[model samples]
Target chain A: MNVEQHHSTWVIILSFFISFILAIMPLPDWALSWRPDWVALVLIYWCIALPQRVGIATGWFVGIILDVLNDTLLGQHALAFSLIGYISVKIYRKMRLFPRWQQAIVVFALIASAKLLGVLIHSLFGSPEMNQPLFYPALTSLLLWPWLFIILRDMRRTYRVS
Target chain B: MISKEERKLVLRLIVFLFASIALMLTDHNSDYLKTVRAQLLGGVYPIQYLVNWPVKAGQSLSKNLNSHFQLLGENANLRDDNLRLQVKLQKFEDIKNENQRLRRLLGASEKLGERVEVAEVLAVNINQSRRKILINKGLSDGVFTHQPVIDAQGVIGQVIEVGIFSSIVMLITDPEHELPVQVVRTGLRTVAKGMGTVNRLSLLYLSNTELNTSIKVGDLIVTSGAGQKFPKGYLVATVIQVNPDIGKPYAQGQAQPRSALERNWEVLLVWQLEPSTVINDEFKTINSQ
Candidate 1:
């Protein structure tokens, strides 16, 4: 297989930039707990779409940026995103063959597990018992996956980004 | 079966995970990561500004399109408020001078006022669990960490992170915060802790003896100035509930914060007069007396 090395790296970087914005955007109090994990969703899409170019390292760095952005414990999101990136990369081929709805379920599991990892570490650090909204973002992310996939797919094709 | 690349991937993940946990541990247990966070905050400043652009645009647009009648009413209200404030300012001048003279006579430090700067809240709900807000003022504006924040009503929070153009204020309602507050009526000094929610603070370790007797519902709480963490006598909260412990040493009570913690837009950052300057003022007042 001939690999196309001419990836529009800026387009990929731009998508991640927008994801970072959404992650930090201010939300109303009612919606605060339900704000979807934008960075995680975008990273997962890139890992699966261009597994060769984006993977564990991309996810890890993005997580660090998010930790700084949200002022959370350092490396909390890093560890979670890295694991999800690895999983997505490993299953990218098989995931592409699955139906869209089936794909959403797997995405939910990936993001939810990552969020669970975050909750665990925070609990270790003595954060209060905030378990109810633990899966809200994951649920929101699951609902968003279908639309996001199409939007990002169009972006990828339009810019011919790997 | 794991292939060669897969093994490499697994090894990389393990190494990264180990490194991050180490980072988290260090950050949790010490202040070493603060410098790193401060440095990275400059890079993030632009991103935050970009996200706030639409909100700022909307505000300016509304201001520009205000109806003539609405503007006339707003101007009248402002003029009315200005006249009332001017009358109060004249009396305030006399009281400040009298207070300074009394403080000099008592040999206490003059602590009447602190210089303050007003900042707009740029963002809120930075994290769901931690109660924090980002303000438009930051390191460039000489904002230091741990500086107290307040509004027209009362205490809001303190600066936790200072970036190039923005700073994060941790509200008193955050689970990690503990404010030393004094009961206005009984002079009972106790620690008011965050209940992990807005408008509510838990006064911890209140003696059972004072419960239901001196510390009751509707009592006012203010900063005790303990540990010099916060300025003295600022309104903090008001007791909303007092549940006494019959046999225990302490009673559990709740207070509502005087400030609108969750709805703040414009906040004041206090510039506490340093002890050295305060001492100098004490000497100057003494010499004059």
Candidate 2:
């Protein structure tokens, strides 16, 4: 059991590292606003699948890293991710029981909340006007959730990662 | 045990939320975290490079896949462009000599040659209103904050933050950006404010009276160099619209930026000239004379 848990730790870190790459990957000008929130989606999946191991602290750490990556106001993503992490942990058990499509809806809500929180933080820093297209990433995140879920699940099971 | 775990989670969330707010407040209010940000960027730099590798590879792959005929055509076109530029270079040399002679007569200090370094654009801000781009050059490459960034056409932006191997450039079209500009035709000075649109910039501080007499559509606008951050006399934009407000004291005019902010793959970072020291030296020379 100890060995299994230790191996699963590598899996979690590796998943997050890939998500970080996806988060910063360059998209074409037109598709930039529509690019999915890769980090948030990955954190949500981990929070649901391995609630005890990954939770609010992990979210905060990842958020800080993302804040540095995006070059935005520091801590803006941290605040949003912490809140999303809390919500995910709070509902992880119920979320695990839902159908894949229904889970996608939950993912949408979670990611949207993070997006809204980010906009609110940005506005507080004197940029009050929000762009309409900023919400497109949430939609893409929702659509990508099922595929992400399946892949992460397959990796976890194949590796016997708890 | 489960209840204890839930309580711990709640406690952790509160702690993180508080820390985040504190960090945001400090980061926005001052430069205390600039070094910290730079250090953090060093860690992220490798990941960014890796993330961008595939795109670079694909671009080279496509270029390599081009037929011999296509390469020959491109090479011929480049040769033609080089010949045309050579002809233009002769005229520029003559102008340079004439300008130096005129400056000597006026006792004005000669303008120093600007040091320029080319950097490739790594990524653009995903957020629509921010209008920033990340470039591959940074402090290690002698890039500093407030260095003017330009493309083949004109001024694109300025470097706002420099990491170890990367930097962030805030484009002139960002909503938060404004630059001092002058009309090349009339020499009318004004401030051009970004209108959150890539194609347009708005000229501000123009009185309704001056707008009528001094400004005209199609007038070329260039940097005034008042702020000492951007050098004087780079093509910035051209006036496209003049709107007179009946009630307001100031008339509104929009100009199109000359730089291809969206399309350029590479940009030039120009070191700033010390305007104050130059002015002081010129004054000393005049007083001695």
Candidate 3:
């Protein structure tokens, strides 16, 4: 039991690390705005799978690291991710009972809210007008959810992460 | 009744949200957290470098795959370009000496040649509204905030934030950026404002009331060195379009920046010739004379 717990901890950390790398990878100019929120999606998955262990605090920490990497206003991603974390943890039980497609829709709504929060923070800081296309990332994240969910779920079961 | 676990979750969320707001407020309002931000960015530097490694490897791999004939052609073209530049340098050397002699006769200080350090581009901001790029050089490399950055073609931008091992450059095409420029043909001074377009800059403060404002399409614009932030006479942009708005006090003009702002892999960070105060005093002396 002790060995399993230790392995699961490493697995969770390794997953977050990979997500961070994906989040910072350079994208072509035309596809930049369409880049998915890899960190957020991963954080949501962990929050759902390990609600007791991963929650708002983990999200806040990861979000702050992302802000540092992106060189954006501090706490902007932190706030958004924390909100996503809270919502996911709140609904994780009911969400797990739903079909995979329904769960993906929930992920869509969660990520969309996070994007909205980011836009709100940017506007509040008096950033120049961003076009409506800023929401492209949320759409891409939604499309990627099902595949990511299946992969992560299999990994969890195979490793007995809980 | 709400469960204890739910209540604790709500409480934790509130706490984190409040902390986030507090952090955002402090970051936006002042420079108090600049040190913290810089140190945190230092931690992120290694990860960013690792993430960028694959792209760099791919670029080199493609270069190595080029045919020998193509390599020979490229080498020959580079050699020809070098010879042409050396011929131009000879003329510049003579002109520079004459200019220095004239300045000495006028009791004016000689303008020193700028010292530059090279830095490699690491990442670019994905946001279209914020035209920024991150480079590998930072405070440890003698880079400082507001240092002018240029590529071989022309001025690209200025360093805005310096981390321990990386820095952010705000490109000339950012909407918030403005630089003083002078027309090469007519010597008319004007402020060039970034138009959020890579190739174009807008000339501001040009009053239509000024009769025969010599600015026209295809006029060359260079730095005026007004703020002493940019060295004097660097190629900035060229006027592409000029339209006098009917009944308006100001005319609108657009210019294409000389720098290939978005494409360069390496740039030079230039240390300004003189401090702002010293430059201001020199300007005053020149004007009084």
- DockQ list for all candidates: 0.69, 0.63, 0.63
Ranking by TM-score: 1, 3, 2
lDDT of each: 0.87, 0.85, 0.85
For residue B85, model 3's alpha carbon misses the true position, in angstroms, by 1.7
Error of 2 at B275 (Å): 9.0
Give model 1's TM-score versus the native structure: 0.93
B82-122 per-residue lDDT for model 2 (tens digits): 99999999999688657756776887763544668899987
- The model with the greater DockQ, 1 or 3, is 1
Q: How close is candidate 2 to the true structure, as a TM-score?
A: 0.90
| iRMSD for every model | 1.5, 2.0, 2.1
For candidate 1, give the docking quality class from DockQ.
medium
What's model 1's lDDT at A152?
A: 95
Give stretches of model 1 more than 4 Å off. A1-7, B110-112, B275-289
**Over the stretch A1-162, how does candidate 1's per-residue lDDT look in tens digits?**
233444578788889999988988877778877888899989989998999889888888988888988898889989999899889999999999998888889999999999888878978998775545778899999999999999999999997776
Q: Which stretches of candidate 3 lie over 4 Å from their true place?
A: A1-4, B109-111, B123-129, B273-289
After TM-score superposition, the amount by which residue B37's alpha carbon in candidate 1 deviates from its true location, in angstroms, is 0.4
Candidate 1, B1-289: lDDT as tens digits: 8899999988988888897899999989999988788878878888888888888788889998999999999999999999999999999978976886787788876456687999998863477777888999988899999999999888998999988778899999988889999999989999999978768899998988888567989999999998686899899998999988888888989999999998877999998886467668868987999
Q: What is the TM-score of chain B alone in each candidate?
A: 0.90, 0.88, 0.87
| TM (chain A) per model | 0.93, 0.95, 0.94
